[model samples]
Target: MMPCYSGYTKSGDKFFICGKLGPHCADARCMDVGTILCDYPVGDGKTCDMPICESHAFEAAPNVHYCPGHALMWRKFVDAGGVERDLKNVVPFAAKERT
Candidate 1:
């Protein structure tokens, strides 16, 4: 007996997205379809882009959401009682918010 695949690309390399093949939520325990991306800025005007379901996403600002990992970090910063001006240094693109 042999296994079958529809395409030449390896399964791991395939890019699954929302819809039929549905991208999975990044959370290991969750099986929900990922419909949104984490908005955490990475660099060069790019974002984290981690696929996440709504339930697992943290809304940082209007329509901006972060994955669980970044979200936790954000929460910790807030809980630490950092001043508002310090946010510009903590977040990758927060300096733009000040402009």
Candidate 2:
């Protein structure tokens, strides 16, 4: 079984966390394939907005949202005026686009 982090959403939703799969890594490339749930619902109260995992979570700076891969890249993006909050709403950019 894949490793995961369990937690509650702001609205009190439970979920199992996994890496955000897509092309936003160190090399502007991503290797995660198939369907991996970056933010998966568990108890189904509302929906957890945080996507966190021990093996995949990376803190770009302090208090910044956890990134799946390429933490530095993400930090740079945020520093360059990117929206930090958006990371939680739309990770694995491709996945968000699909849905």
For lDDT, the strongest prediction is 1
Clashes of each: 0, 0
Model 1 stretches astray by more than 4 angstroms: 1-21, 87-99
Residue pairs with clashing backbones, model 2: none
Highest TM-score, which number? 1
State each model's C-alpha RMSD to the native: 10.8, 16.0
CA lDDT scores, all candidates in order: 0.74, 0.44
Off by over 4 Å in 2: 1-48, 69-99
User: What would the per-residue lDDT of candidate 1 be over residues 1-99, giving only the tens digit for each residue?
Assistant: 322212113343433223354577788776666668999989999999999877788999999999999999888888887646586678464445565
What TM-score goes with each of the models?
Answer: 0.63, 0.22
